[model samples]
Target: MGSTVLDVVNLIIARVNAAWWWASSGSSGPMPL
Candidate 1:
């Protein structure tokens, strides 16, 4: 149970980081296709 929770938290953190990176990058310039 502890391991499963840790795995889920890691996945969520990774997704949030990706989204943050995208937002910051887009604000700097237009996104590429």
Candidate 2:
């Protein structure tokens, strides 16, 4: 089945949140945003 727009947005948001959390909690340095 094809993915919906909401699904795409949710995926993007999840990725951003994961990255933010990682940046804050990880020693990888500050977030790119």
Candidate 3:
């Protein structure tokens, strides 16, 4: 159970970082692009 939660948290962090990087790219309007 603890490991599962930790994995999920890591996944969420990766996704958020990717989205942030994309948004920082000026020409992008939003994420999911």
* The best candidate in terms of TM-score: 2
Against the reference, the lDDT scores of all candidates come to 0.73, 0.80, 0.78
Segments in model 2 whose C-alpha atoms lie over 4 Å from true places: 28-33
Q: Pull out the clashing pairs in model 2.
A: none
* 15: Cα error in model 1, Å: 0.3
Off by over 4 Å in 1: 1-3, 27-33
- Candidate 3 residue lDDT tens string, 1-33: 467988999989999888888878864765752
Cα lDDT of model 2 by residue, 1-33, tens digit = 689999999989988987878877874765645
Candidate 1 — what's its lDDT? 0.73
Q: Count the backbone clashes (under 3 Å) in each candidate.
A: 0, 0, 0
TM-score of each: 0.68, 0.69, 0.64
Distance from true location, Cα of 30 in model 2, Å: 14
Clashing pairs in 3: none
Range of the 10 consecutive residues with the lowest summed lDDT in candidate 1 = 24-33
Clashing pairs in 1: none
